[model samples]
Target: MSQETASWVRDVLAGRAEPVEPRPAATVMLVREGADPGGLEVYLLRRVSSMPFAPGAHVFPGGSVDRRDIDHEVRWAGPAPAEWARRLGAAEPLARALVCAAVRETFEESGVLLAGASADEVVSDTRGADWEADRTALIDHSLSFAEFLDRRDLVLRSDLLRPWSQWITPLAEVRRYDTRFFAAVLPEGQQTRDVGGEADHVAWMRPAEAIEGWRSGAMAMLPPTVSSLKDLAAYATLPGVMAARRTIVPIQPELREVDGEVRLVVPEGVDYPL
Candidate 1:
């Protein structure tokens, strides 16, 4: 850890610093099949260094849940919010908001909409001038997610999302997020655009390649991202990943000073090479 990180841990451990409450957030790993058999690729964004949180780090598409995301008026399909609540171990409203935020953020950050005109369908092409206008509005908060979907007569495809895991920001950090992780296959016919906003660069990379980049010091990632990628590397195909059952458990790393260096201590069985 750096000098600042070590000092923060010392202050927080000594009760000289108070930890901020983590904000509820959501993120999704958008995956697709590669040209090679049993190969999977994931979308990643490198946040701009000037951003307040996770700057210069490669991350999945996501953000904090908006108040409008919880509104029940939004169209829905597949499993109900109650079912999602059961799966996520959260309340129905929160579960709905998390799913909504996951879809909304993915579209805002990657130009991929996890919605369709009918329950069994997904939007084929989210391109052209009018689509860009609504996307811009959503980013600016000038339009609510419910309103956007209602206006377009689209249903939020809840079945498209698969619950993966949950991670809470460590107490030593000033900005914290209680983020829920989700996995979804890239909808057919929808392509990722540069969509430059919070991120300066974006790309599709196999999980193994991403892990190698992190190991080689060519990429920056938090422990959660590293762990997620490591776990993802185990899967051979997108369907295999989406079909696997997961128990959503919250993992929060603690800060400790060992051998004169501050280290983030994760729980047992959750291993990541530092």
Candidate 2:
């Protein structure tokens, strides 16, 4: 931790400062099969340094929920909101909004849309001027997820996503998020483009390779991103990752004075890459 962060941690711990309430947010890890038979690769975006949160970090596509994310008019498929509520350990309303934000952010940041015309189908491609216009509208807040789905005559394919984990930003940080992490397979026929906005670079990399890059200081990632990459590295294929059941639990790292320096400490047995 930097000296400035350590000072903030000390202030917060000493009750000289109050921690900010974290905003609810969601992020998704998009995975796909690689050339190596059982190996998988993940989609990642290097956030531009100008970003307030995790600037210059290689992160998944996600952001905070907009008020309209809770719109009831959104078309849906797969699990019901009640089931999503149970899985996310949230009420039906917030659960629905989180899922909506996940799908919307995925489409907004990446070109991939996890929606289809019917319950069993998925959008094959999201290219061309029309799709770009809608995406831009959503980014600018002129278009809502519900309005976009309704206009496209599509339903959010919730079945394509699996709950991974929930992470809360540490109290000492100036900005915080009660963010949920989700795992998803890159839908067939859809491709990721160099969608320039918050991110400066995008790539499809093996989880282990990403980890190695972080270790070599070639890439920067937050704790949740590193932890998620570690989890993904355990799986050999996309199916293996999607098939594994996850018990969604919130992990909020604590600020501790370790050897005269303040550091973010995760739970025991959970590794935090230095």
- lDDT string for model 1 (156-212, tens) is 999999999999998887778999999999999999998898999999999999999
Question: Candidate 1 — which pairs collide?
Answer: none
- Evaluated against the true structure, the overall lDDT of model 2 is 0.91
lDDT of 1: 0.92
Q: Which 10-residue window of candidate 2 scores lowest in summed lDDT?
A: 265-274
Instruction: Name the weakest run of 10 consecutive residues (lDDT summed) in model 1.
Output: 1-10
Q: Which candidate has the highest lDDT of all?
A: 1
Per-residue lDDT of 45-101 in model 2, one digit per residue for the tens? 999999887889999999998899999999999999999999999899999999999
Which portions of model 2 show Cα errors greater than 4 Å? Answer: 1-6, 271-274
Candidate 2 accuracy as TM-score: 0.96
Task: Please count the clashing residue pairs in each candidate, in the order shown.
Answer: 0, 0
